[model samples]
Target chain A: MRRNRVLAAVAAGLLLTGALTACSATGEGGPVTVKLLQFQEARADVVKDLIPEFEKAMAKKGRPVKVDLVTDILTDDQFRTKITQQFYSGTAPDVVDMGGSNVTGMAGAGYLLKLDTYLRTWDGWDEYYPSVKKGARQRDGSYYSVPHEASVQSLFYRKDVLQRLGIDTAQPRTWNELIARLKKVRAKTGEAPLVIPAGTAWGGGSWTEGLLPIVAGTGSTLYDEKSGKWKLRSKGLSATFDLYADLVEADLLPVRDLHNPNPWEPTKYEKFPQGTLPVAAQGSWGWKYDWGPEGAAPIKNSREKIGTWDYPALVPGTEPAPISGGGFGYSVNADAAHPDAAVELAKWLSSGKALARQLTAVGAVSPRAGLADTAPYSNEPSLLQAEGKLKSSIQPPLGDGEDRVSQAVQSATAKILAGEADGSQAADAFAEEAEQLLGSTRVAE
Target chain B: MTTVKNPAARPTRRRRERAALPLLLGPSVLLIAVFVIAPAAYGVYLGLTNTQLTGFAARDPQFVGLENFRNLLGSADFLESLGRTGEFVLWSAIIGQTVLGMLAALLLRQKWLRGKGLFGALMLLPMVVPEVVASLTWASVLSSESDGTFNRLLGLFGSGAAAPLQEYPMASVILINVWRGIAFAMIMFQAALEDVPDELIEASRMDGASALQVFRHITLPLIRGPVFLYLLLTTITTVGVFGLVYFLTQGGPGQDTEITSIYIFQSAFKYSQIGLGSAASVILLILLTILGMTYARLAKVEV
Candidate 1:
């Protein structure tokens, strides 16, 4: 009897251990736990709040799944490192926050699930803007992610400061005219006239925000789509560097603040709000998320106080437009256990109602086709203005080596800021670095 | 009678003991092999490949032996970072922290010194403060604005409005490191100083040796073993430091303080070139090994 009792005890213990392991491994006998990852706090909060609603809706649909919201407030670089490691280990969250430039690279690596099949059945697919679809789809014509929002780069200036200094509040039609206006501001007031992110301190922003649009305005492409090579030695790149050099030489740029560890904090939050930084190259989100009533540094009556300008043409007679860039969105991990359930959650997160909430919460423009015509978006004038600009917005060619290109551009701009190199020399350094990073075949002179 | 019958049993037990020795050490050997040797070997292999965090290489990294090393060796930025790292380790770790720590340790040993416990605790405060906190504190103090603590102090002397961090990025980082590291050196040297024989110091003093001479010839020579050990420890720790300087300058103000560690991080994560970073790490490992061997050789002297 005692021997039988010992045998029975061992059997029970083994069974318990096996059950626990299975439960932990696959959430067996419990809700199918789908993990959702997000980087930004505001967006994460919105998603976190929507988790319960998703759980209830899924239960009603007879496919119940619990979402575990994992929030990582990290810089772009850190986030990339984490997500890459997670996917490489096959332990990635079911849903991930995929940024614009990350879509092509991550999808190509087989980390993201091909969402073409899922989107074909998703009813909300028809509601996304054409640009949103284009942005979300990789070059192979497969959609790996769904669009969450869209943003456009522009010149944001303090209207009161410019008007007070007798500088024209009207948009400058060309780069030279823009320079003249900035110089006039400097002459009229000792305040730093403009801030264009430069150097390693500003990271990728030196290229994306400060230089890319102007390079486009000059009718040059960083990446030759047809040739499939990066244009590191282009005249447009040199001209942009020259413009940076000019700004440094003329003392019109806030070089000191630009080198701050968190350059944006001072330039966008403090100095600009205080009217000491008169103009800056920023994004549409800057209206509410940077300087408006709910921003990091709120400027009173910011909608009326701040004005926007299309980045001017780098050359004469070239039409200039704001550069449209992709905003953060959700993608399912290829290795996810319940791809169907994760897809359902992702679709719900980007539904019209969810998209509207995300836009208002994060101060982003809606990527939904007709959602901007109603309620929250329609009530905000700045959002309407940004939406209008979206019709003619130009998006630069982006792909695998964009990050490396951004780093190279940052290095070049750093040299310009430090007075160590002229425009031609900086451009040469940029070409050399780009060639070294991407190999000789990928870089074009 | 029983003892006499166990003659073969003794040899049997001896044989069994020999057989069990391997079993005893098997777990430890396996642990070391798995944890230390395996990772280091993998790191070396990774150093020889074109592994990246994303893009084509990330999925199917191809072996590109010595290419990363060659690229880094030829790169001006990498070379500059190496030079900066050398300067940082020398001034901040070897000299500044060591000298100040020695002084503090000597001061604490004085019989006339009051509140020795309080003084020692205060000196150790920086070591207890988390690295992030220390970095943030220094950043606030050395902020560019006039209201910053350090700038405010400068203002009282009528020489204000100075952005010390921007103007002296390397110096600022080194000083903050020294502040963080002094307590460690102090503790090591203090323990060594306590072990010094009183008879030796008394004998030297009776010979009419000056205070400085006694310290230089007696205390210094007596503490050489701990000094070497301390140097090795500090050197290794200081070389790997990331958060302290990263939070403060991030190797910025135009790469003024881009030490090797910062460069490695940028190359690996920011630039997504894991192989290049691994090559740099391999080089750093080799250099550290050489330094450790040299220190070990020197430390083998008789106390």
Candidate 2:
């Protein structure tokens, strides 16, 4: 009888929870309901605010949407598993959140609905930057996702510390100059000069922030546009690895602490602000989301202590190029019941009020123009710098083999850094790994 | 109790028994067939194809018999993962847990420790704690940084914060698993000891046999069943452990702790190479089956 009572209570609780979550849809007069599943659970608040705003907008249009929006948050692996299961089971939500390359892969696999028609028809379509818009277009010239926010990675340093040591705060013009600055910083600070995200956990980052900037500076990109293959064995790629090799030989990058899942915790939060480390590759989000007041380890006087340099150029006598094109955006599931309504909802959610709300909540740089007057972003002046850098980006492809390419680059770089192989050999290994994973696809020279 | 023998009724009774068989065992048999047997068969099929989570293969998989297996054979990552898994099982299950737990159970049987139920309960704290929590706790303990508890303790001894996981990644993970698993092993051993014939031990002592001699000749032979049972359970469990080791190390510092299970999981999920993962799992399954059968044969236990 007690066991039965306990089970009854559990059943009652589940029913209550379901009822509360279903009022807009399953209630007596629920409207055309649309479901949105967000993987980055942290920013669910933005969408929570958007749902009501969307309803209000639709109500004003005399076609009120009593859309039951479910914001399910999950870790990366859980999201991958759950979303894939949903996809295979035909239970995926009408709308879902995905990253840049994730959007490409999802769209390419026919899992996501294309947004080209909606984007072209949307009034606010012209507001987004051309580069930002271009980044969303898959190889078939279709918009798979609506670009929401973007980030630019560069070498973050301590201006005060560099000034104290009488080193130039001016941006590095070449790889050698950057290395010289790091060596000088090491001699003066008596701490490790740099921290590269090289561990297995920092899979994509190991290549994106660590190696790609150098590759980009030397006029190399991951995707071979003309041939539509990854350029893993290029001279610039090997040179990028060699630069890391140089850092490894000098014991510049902190090999020990780099093994941590969040190398940024030590490098950005503790070491950089504490003046123990003077230089590291950092994304724009690191300013506010990482070490600012909103961060896990908020540094006092973060602005005064930290500074950004154009990530050092590969060749001497050239300005460093910023690597861009990574952010969260919404994609409508291809198998959505309300595909048109979902696309319309997605269009509304990706711009104006909703997107701004999200950008503010995540403290991300707005990929589109005309959002400079927002509260949190307006309050932080450094975001303006980040905003300016977004246009000057070297965009990578967002599709199949993109993730594998990242892993291959990361593994190769790790081997080179650990002295298991030289840059050229690591280059060869990278080629082999990439080709093996992406069969019949040759690495572009 | 039979009053009359009816040959005609006997065939009818046999028919009734046969009819009842299907009704009695149908649900469980059906469930096992669908969930277990079908999935295993499907996994073997997946191994023979180029199925993946992404790309063209995800949409249109092509069958290539033994290709994935052939690739896995030459792959250093696969071999290394299997080798590391073997090392982890040998250390954590075969040696560490069995020896420590047996010794602990033996020591706790003393009359001087009578009525110390709380002490015995305290020993089980690690086992009862959730796997993620235990792994996280040890992550803090094994951390080389200043915030690490183990390093903090070592600071009093005038030693700096040192990276245990960095220097000994696999051993650290194995030791953490062993520590958590030892409680269960202890409980099993303790229960097994109750079935040990006390009279035989008393007679051995009376005969002036040394304690070691008594344990070797009498105690071991008596509890051989439980010992084999413990080995089988631990080995099977340790071979499949993914969460604790994953939480603690995430199969890295460059594949140092990427056990076979973790490798297969990463391939299928993280890397999106489902066909390769399926192939790898098939190999792992065969290896485990062989090991299990070997142990069962040794124990003379029908499995």
Which candidate has the top score in lDDT?
1
Write model 1 residue lDDT over A296-392, tens digit each, in one string. 7888998778888888877655765787756777899998989998988888888767767777777777777787666666677787678767767
lDDT of 1 at B127: 100
Candidate 2: list runs displaced more than 4 Å.
A1-30, A39-42, A66-82, A315-319, A353-357, A372-380, A416-419, A442-445, B1-25, B109-112
- Measured with C-alpha atoms, the lDDT of residue A143 in candidate 2 is 82
State, as a TM-score between 0 and 1, how close model 1 is to the true structure.
0.91
Quote the lDDT for B126 in model 1.
99
- State each model's CA lDDT, in order: 0.84, 0.77
Q: Could you give candidate 2's per-residue lDDT for residues A1-445 as a string of tens digits? A: 9999999999999999889888745434545667887766556766776788888887788665656666666655457656765765678888887767566556656788878888888877898887788777776778877777887777888788788988888877777888888888878766777876774656666766666656766775667655767766766777777777788787788876677755666777778777788777877777766776767567678788888887667754556777773777778888877777687777787776676667766657788888787655566677777888788777644545666777677778767655787767778888887777776553554
Chain B TM-scores per candidate, in order, are: 0.93, 0.94
Residue B47's lDDT in candidate 1: 92
In Å, candidate 1's interface RMSD is: 1.8
Q: Which stretches of candidate 1 lie over 4 Å from their true place?
A: A1-31, B1-28, B145-147, B155-161, B301-303
Q: Per-residue error at A125 for model 1, in Å? A: 3.1
Q: What is the lDDT of residue B103 in candidate 2?
A: 82
Q: What is the per-residue lDDT of model 1 for residues B176-226, given as tens digits with 9 covering 90 to 100? A: 999999999999999999998988888988999988999999999889999
Give the least accurate 10-residue stretch of model 2 chain B, judged by summed lDDT: B51-60
